[model samples]
Target: MRIGINLLNLSQDRFGGVEQYITNLIGHMADSGENLTLFLFLKRKLKNVFPQHEKIKTIRFRKVMDSADVYDAIKKCKLDLWFCPLHRSYLPSVPVPTVATIHDVLHTEYPDFVPGGLEENNRYYGQYTASFDAVITVSDFSKSTIARQLSIPEKKIHVIPLNAPAIFDQAPAKITMKGVKQKYQLPDSYAIYPSSYNPHKNHLNLLKAILILREKYNTTIPLVLTGYADKSNGVYQSVLQFIRERSLEKQVWVLGYVPPEEMPSLYWNSSFLVFPSLYEGFGIPLVEAFKTKTPIVCSNKGSIPEITDHAALYFNPENPKEIALKMMELLNPLTRKQLSEKSSLRSRHFSWKKTASETLKVFRSVTRN
Candidate 1:
């Protein structure tokens, strides 16, 4: 079967979840010999590394394609279906079946989390949920919420849990901790929180939890925060203010937008990982932590429990005191090792191969329809 994909947003330097999903899925499908021909649609000049297969050919669109041109490509290419990995314009130009992945409903449910999202993103949520043929969500939480929000049939929405790529299962890089420390200027004995300052990630709560441990108790271990931070968001502003108010500028290391390559070491070298998201369709960091054999202190919200099981020390995401208590539990050696072993045990349940096999089933069913 021939498949056309919207790869315009793809990049090799992605620190976001959608980019990882697209890049790894294409690579795995290419290597799996599914007898599928892929035609990619991209508009940007970003660096791309698609699989080299006779079956796969990239069709780069010009800076813009008119409505007529988009339809022309759809019919002219004779694509069996068009797959938009991220949310694309919900209205498809051609009659071919359309499938799109909706990672999180945060933008719809919690508009405060996004920049002008309360006013701007509703149309996207409305379009994709109503217009798409089949909706693929990253978790059951999203499937249920999106179904209600869009008033779409539950059967039309499918829940496909995400998986860590082979990179997570691979051995650590040759770089030493000393080198990573110098490269990122990271300190020894630090706790790592790799999520961004996005409000839904509950960065404000995490910051408050860390401050409780440091300021209230004078715990000296530094907290390493790796994510993009813009001051406009309430969470970002609060985090910045907390650091200044508590005089925690030195205790907090905010490495805004670290590259994807260094993520593994950052997870492994950390004393423990903290992911107290107020909301997540699927917390990608929990799986990454489990794969890296890193201990996690994650929130009980969303699919964290479904994914992490008993592997993590759960905390109430809203109460900063609760997150602090969980964080304190990690400092105990007995609890630390227990969580470490359980994390690795739970991680074995998820894999890209498994994800691809299941996803391909959905693709096959959709094409037949």
Candidate 2:
């Protein structure tokens, strides 16, 4: 079957979660030999990142996302089906069937965390999702959330889980870790939290938990944060202020946005992964930590328990004391080692191949209907 993918959402910031999802999914789909011809739709000047294959072709548009050029380019492709991986419908009404992936309805669920408020979210989903023949979501939780938020039938939403990026499966060499540590000037012992400074990410609670670990429990290990930080956000400024007021200059290290090349070593060298997010469709970091044989201490909210199972230690994300206590438990070498072993086994449950095959089924089903 021939499929046209809306790739105009991808940007140079390849480290963005959704961009990584698109890149890895396309790569695995290309290698899987599913007898599928893919036409990638992107802006004209952007370099094509996917591999060149007889079955895969790049279609360039003058403008991307909600543009006449995007609709014209996609309509010209004349594919059997169209898939928009970025969760919204960017193209105009087309002759072929349409399937779009809605990662989550975070804006509707937590309106305060998102800008433009509920009215903006209503218009966003109303315009983008109304024409799709079918919808795809990352987890069962997200499927339900999107169904309620969009007032769409639950049966129309297909729940297909995402796998960790391919890089997480391989461990870095000890020398590579040492080099990375020296280059970043990272602390010798630290727990890594690789997420942006979004309000819903609940960074404030994580920082408070780290402080409690230091003062009350006397755990001197620093917390390493790696994600993009914009100074304009009040949350970002408040985080820095909290660090200063608490005298945690040495105990909290914020290394803004590590590249894809260095993420494995960063995960490999960390003691464990701490993801105290208040909400997530699916925590990709949980799978990454499991792949790296790094134990996780994350929130019990959303899909965390569903994804991690017994491989992680759970805590209420809002309670900093509970987060600290659970984190403290993982500090034990033997316990961490056992959890890490279990993590490798659990990581086997997810893979790019499985994700692609299941996604292909959805695409095929949409065409059949």
Candidate 3:
């Protein structure tokens, strides 16, 4: 079977989780040992992003290429099925059956977090999801949200949980804590929150929690933040402003956009993972923490509870006091040890290979119809 993957929406290191999902899914699919030919439709600049695989064919187009041009190229492939890993549909129509991975319905659920608000989100996400033959999402929460918010049938949406990047499995062995600490100027021990500075990520609340920990409990907990910290982004600017206003420069270290290979070291050396995001389709960082046996204190909202289950100590993301309390609880060595063991057991439940197998089944089923 020939399957075309629409990856034009991605750029190297730009989209944190979405990019990881697409690249890892493709890598596993290529190595799945299935008799399948994969056609990748991506920008010319991303030619070297994906590894050279015998079963994969690259169809590169310039970044300036319009929808019509992209459609024309996809049509030429004569594929049995087309998969759009990212949420939105890039093409109006395709010759073959189409499947799209809608990671979340965050835009509609939390309009304030989105840039142009409801109307803009509806324009991009509302109309196009139903056009696909099948929809894939990261969690049951996301699947239900997509179904209800977009008016798509629940039966049409498949919930496939995501795994941590394959790098984490081997990263600890390769990375040195001393080197990673020196390179990033990280404190001896700190909670790591690996997420971009999006408004919905609730970075402000996390920082506020840090301040509360210091002022109320007189306990100083160092925090190391990783992900894209674009200076132009208002959320990022606001986080910096909060850190400065509260005199949290010493307690908080913002390490923007750490390399993927080095992430495991950060987790390995950290006291615990602190995820204060108000929303997530499926919190990938939680899984990463699970894989690394790193204890986690995260928001109870969204797919977090669904994903972490018994592996994490939960807190209300909107409440700085609750978040601070959870952080204090995680500092207990006994609590951390128990959660770490649970995390190891939970990590066994997810893998990229399983994700690839199930995804391939969806492709075959769609094409066969």
Candidate 4:
């Protein structure tokens, strides 16, 4: 079968979980003896994970301005199915079968955090997905969220959990770790929280918890924040102000965006991983922590509990005291060792090969119908 992968919405600057999802899925499918074609923006660079295969073809465009362009492209390719891994597609209609992955309905769930609010969300998740033959989600909780919010049948959504990037599964070489530490000027011992500065990410609460850890609990482990920090956003500005007003400049290190190759070393060298987000689709970082055997302290909200499955300590994200208490609780050597073992075991349950296999099943089912 000829399968077409649409990557029109991929941004040049931002390479987050969604980009990883598409790359892993396509890379695995390319090796699965299936005919595949990728339709991406003209100057965007895909990672080295993609292998050369005779079955794989790529078509590039400067930009897709409207549905007619996408529709015409697919018609010319004569593909049996089209897949939009980014939850939305430009085409209003397709000649053959089509599937889209709905990562989350966070826009409608937390309208305040989203840029365009509910109206734009309505177009993306509602109208765009309604045109597809099938929809895929990262977790059961997300599947239900999309089904209920978009008014689609539960059976129409496929739940496929995301795995950590392959690098997370391997131990970084000692020399590489040392270089990464020196290159980024990382702390000797610190907790890492890898996420963007979004309101729903709850960086403010994490900052509050850090203050309590330092002042109330006498904990000295600093925080290492790594992700794309949007200086344009007020939330990012607020976090900076909070750090300054509380005199936390020395206690917190905001390492804007780290390269993918440096992540495993960063996670391995950290004391632990802390994720205090108010909501998430699948919590990919939780799995990354599991793979690296990094003990975790995260919120008991959204799909976090569903994904972690008792592998890590949980706290109420809104309560800074609770977050601080969990942070202290995991500081014990015995507790950290035990939880890290459980995390390693839990990490075994997810893999990119399995994700690709399950996705292919959905594609066959959709096209056959």
Candidate 5:
């Protein structure tokens, strides 16, 4: 089958879970000998992950002022199936089959999370609902949300859990401790919070928890913040303000954007990983933490409990005291070791090779008349 993977969202992103999913899927599909032709689109930031795929046919569409330019490109390609790995609400301009992955509906869960979020979220949801041949989601919770919000049948969506890179499940690099430590400028026994500065990530509460931890522990294990700060959203700015207001400039380090290769090392050097996201379809960072032997302190909200599955400590996202208490436990050597052990065990449940094989099965099942 001539499967066309939409490189639209993957093209534009600066390395996140969904982008990694697309890149991994396409790479694995190429190796699987499937006739998968990626409709490769380029954005300014995306590195060439599809360079070696002979089966992948790339079409570059300029970032036109009108969305119709993108529409015209897809229709003109005349693909038998369009696989959109990164979620967007692009309607099909042609009758050929289109499959999309909807990771989450965050704005619906926390409308106040970002500016103009609800309207855009609803607009995207309305446009893409039932238009695809099949929809893919990371968790059952998200499937129901999509079904209820979009008014699409639950059966119409496929549940494919997100996968981690082999690097995460692989052995940690034997780089010098000082090298990695100096790279992130991290002190001993610090915690990690790997996420964009989006509000639904609920980082403000993390700062509050950090303050609580500081008052209790009286140590400097900074909470490292990675990912792009969307100035338009004000989430990152609010976090900065909160830090300054509390004289936590030294306690919270905003490492604007870390390259992908450096991430696993950061995960290894940290004492533990904390994800206080208010909502998520699937917590990819938690899985990464698991794979890298990093203990976790994640929020009990959204699909975090489902995703982590009792592998890590959970706290109410809104409860700063509870979050701080979890961090305290995280800092304790024995408890951290136990959580890290459990993380290793839980990490086994996910893999990119398995995800790729499953995704291919879906393709065969759908395309076979």
Candidate 6:
């Protein structure tokens, strides 16, 4: 089977989840020993992102390749299937069956976070998805949302869960952890939230919960945040403003965009994971915590509950008090130990190899039709 993967939408370290998803999926697929020939279509600058494999071929284009160029490339590949791992493809029409992974319908579900609101969300996510032969999503929640919001049949949208990056599985050496701790100026004991500064990530409410912990409970829980933060992002700016206004400078440490290699150390050293996001198609950090045997205290919203299942202590994301209470609960040694055990056990349920195998099934099924 010949499969073409569209990786043009990704840039190095920019798209956290989608980028991880594609790279992991391809890695597993190439190593799966299946009778498959994979063609990767990406910008020339990103050619080195995926390692060389006998089953994989790279088709690079200039950074400025437009829609026509993309379409022409797909046509020339003459693939049995074309897989767009992120939402939609640039090609208007392709020579082969198409499958797209629409991670979430967050734009339509929460237009407030999206710029230009519903009109813009619809323009990007609404009509374009319908053109694909099949849609892939990370969770049942996302599958349903994509179906209802986009008016695509539920049967057409496949639910394939995601796993944490393989890097999280290996325990970081004590010396390495010491180095990461010193490099980031990490607290001796702190909660970690690894998410980009998107409004839907709800960093503001998490900060409020931290403040509540200090004022109401008289408990000061240090927090270490990891993900992209930039001056240009209004949401990140708002998070900074909230931290300043609440005097949470001491309690909160923003270690923006920690490298993938250093993440395991952060997880190993953290007291527990705190995820107060308002939305997620699939919470990768939850699994990361599970893989590291780190307890989780997270929001009971979107696909979070589905992904985390009983491994985490759930709290309403909109209620800072509830979030604070959960955080407080997780601080107990017994509670943390118990959840950590569950976290370890639950980590067994997901793997990149499984994701790749199921995805290959999707490719074969689509191509057969």
Candidate that would win on lDDT? 6
- What lDDT tens digits, residue by residue, belong to model 4 across residues 163-273? 998888789999999999898787888899998778899999999998988889888668999888678877789888998999999989888889999999989988899
Q: What tens digits encode model 5's per-residue C-alpha lDDT throughout 243-342?
A: 8999998778889888776788888888999999989999889888988888998899888999899988999999988988878777689999999999
Q: How many residue pairs collide in each prediction?
A: 0, 1, 1, 0, 0, 1
What is the lDDT, from 0 to 100, of the residue 5 in candidate 6? 89
Write model 3 residue lDDT over 1-369, tens digit each, in one string: 899898777767565888888888999999999999899987888857888999999988776446777777777887889888875545766777888988987888789887778888887765676678998899989988888888889888898888999987764654486788889888888899989888899998988898888999999999998888768989899988998988888888988888877888999999899999999999889999989999988999999999998788999999999999999998899999999999889999889999999998888888883
Model 2, position 54: C-alpha lDDT score: 82
The TM-score values for the models, in the order shown, are 0.91, 0.94, 0.96, 0.94, 0.90, 0.96
**lDDT agreement with native, every candidate:** 0.76, 0.83, 0.86, 0.84, 0.77, 0.87
Backbone clash total for model 6 is 1
In the range 1-369, model 6's lDDT, one tens digit per residue, is: 888888777777565888889889999999999998899987788747888899999988887446777777666877788888865454656777888888987878788886778787777665566667888889999998888888889988989999999888789999999999999888899999999988899988888899998998999999998888777989888888888998889889988888889999999999999999999999899999999999999999999999988888999999999999999998799999999999999999999999999998888787883
| Residue 290 lDDT in candidate 6 | 92
lDDT of 2 by residue, 208-231 (tens): 998888889888667988887777
lDDT, candidate 2, at 83: 86
Q: What range of 10 consecutive residues in model 2 has the weakest lDDT sum?
A: 63-72
* Total clashes for model 3: 1
lDDT of 1 by residue, 1-369 (tens): 778887665554535777767777777766666878778776657544666777777776666546666667778888888888865544544478777887766766787666557446766565455556787788878888878766778898888778775667864765754567779777867789887666678777777887788768766667888876656856677888878987888888888787666778888888899888878888778889889888988889877777788888899999998998889888888888988898889888877776766666777788883
Which segments of candidate 3 are over 4 A away from where they belong?
13-15
